[model samples]
Target: MIEERGRVLSVEAGAVWVETVRTSTCGSCAAKAGCGQALLSRVGSGAKRGFIRALTDRQWQIGDEVFIGIPEDAVVRGALWVYMVPLLGLFASALLAQAAGVAEPGMIGAALLGLAAGFAVVRWHGQRAQRDPQMMPQVLRSAGQVMPFAPEGRLNG
Candidate 1:
């Protein structure tokens, strides 16, 4: 499970709205100084607040701090779906156009069309996945409770 700490912003039927500070591991990344992402983070004040609605059965109050978690496999599958679909579409359509002896411009156009089709597929899948309980993040526990084990490399205070 991947987890983050957030404060409850609101409560609703079977869910809670959470506000969290967005954090990055850019400081320890090998390509920290070379990547555009790292540069963009440096330009900003470093911590930005983001809001997300997490599913939970337990009642929570507005000021409560909690831990939210999502399964690691869900994240990996999402990344693969988002990236591979478009790339495969581009290659497959371009190959088909070449085999059919289409002109160079026609092949390029086909590739572009295939890429758009791929994006359409991704959007469709995302809408469907939103209703899948396994794909949604959940409220794990209250942050104020003592952890069974201290996090790696950190000692309990």
Candidate 2:
């Protein structure tokens, strides 16, 4: 599970809106002086805050700090769908246009059209996935709460 700490902004039915600040690790990285990402990070320092609606069963009060988690597999799958689908569409349509003896200009148009269609598909999938529980992040627990330690092979008493 991947997790982040956030403060609860509001509570709704079966969910809570949490605010988190994006922190960059560039300051500690050895390649900070040579990395393009480090430069971009410095340029965008003002817009680091983000709000997320996290699913949770417990009712949390406003201003409560909590941890949220999502499955690693979910992140990987989402990244693949968002990137690979459009690329595949572009190449497949361009190849088809070539096989049909389309002019270079026509092939380029076909590739662009395919890329747009792929983006459309991704948008549609995103809307559908909004209702999928597995795709949503869940509130793990309040950051202030402590877990009881259980001894080896024994449950907490």
Candidate 3:
């Protein structure tokens, strides 16, 4: 499970609104001093956003610091086909068509069809994946002695 901590902004019977801290990866880039991403981050450092999601039969109150859990398997499987399948399909279609003496137009169509099929596969898999128990997120109260949820790291005393 992958866990993140966030503060509850509001709570309803079936859902809780939380605001999570956003952190940028630009700080670790080798070219941070010259990268456009770093420049943008410097200009946008203090901006914060709110996120809202429905809870699964769990009740939380405003000001609660909750730990949100996402299953590791779901993330790994989702990333794999979402990125790799479409790329492989496009490459294979183009290569096979060219090897068989297919014309440029025909090859283009085949590649496009492959890409479309890849997207359809991903969409279909996503729907089915959501129905799987491992894909859901669960909210839990942090360990004893609650502390404020920090966006960047563990709560500081």
Q: Candidate 3, residues 42-136: lDDT per residue as tens digits?
A: 88757655474636467666667777778788789789989988878888888889999999999999898888888888899889977775676
Give every collision pair in model 1: none
lDDT of 2 by residue, 8-113 (tens): 7779999999877789899999999999999999887587777899999998887778999999999998999899999988999999999999999999999999
What's the C-alpha lDDT at position 90 in model 2?
A: 93
Question: Per-residue CA lDDT of candidate 1, range 52-93, in tens?
Answer: 899999998876789999999999999998999998999999
Model 1 residue 2 CA deviation (Å) reads 0.9
Error of 2 at 21 (Å): 1.3
- Whichever of 2 and 3 has more lDDT, that candidate is 2
lDDT of 3: 0.73
- Residue 2 lDDT in model 2? 93
Q: Which window of 10 residues has the lowest lDDT sum in candidate 2?
A: 146-155
TM-score of each: 0.86, 0.89, 0.71
Model 2, stretches more than 4 Å misplaced? 145-157
Each model's lDDT comes to 0.87, 0.87, 0.73
Q: Kindly report which residue stretches of model 3 are placed more than 4 angstroms away from their true locations once superposed.
A: 10-15, 28-30, 43-47, 50-57, 143-157
Scored against the true structure, residue 55 in model 3 reaches a CA lDDT of 60
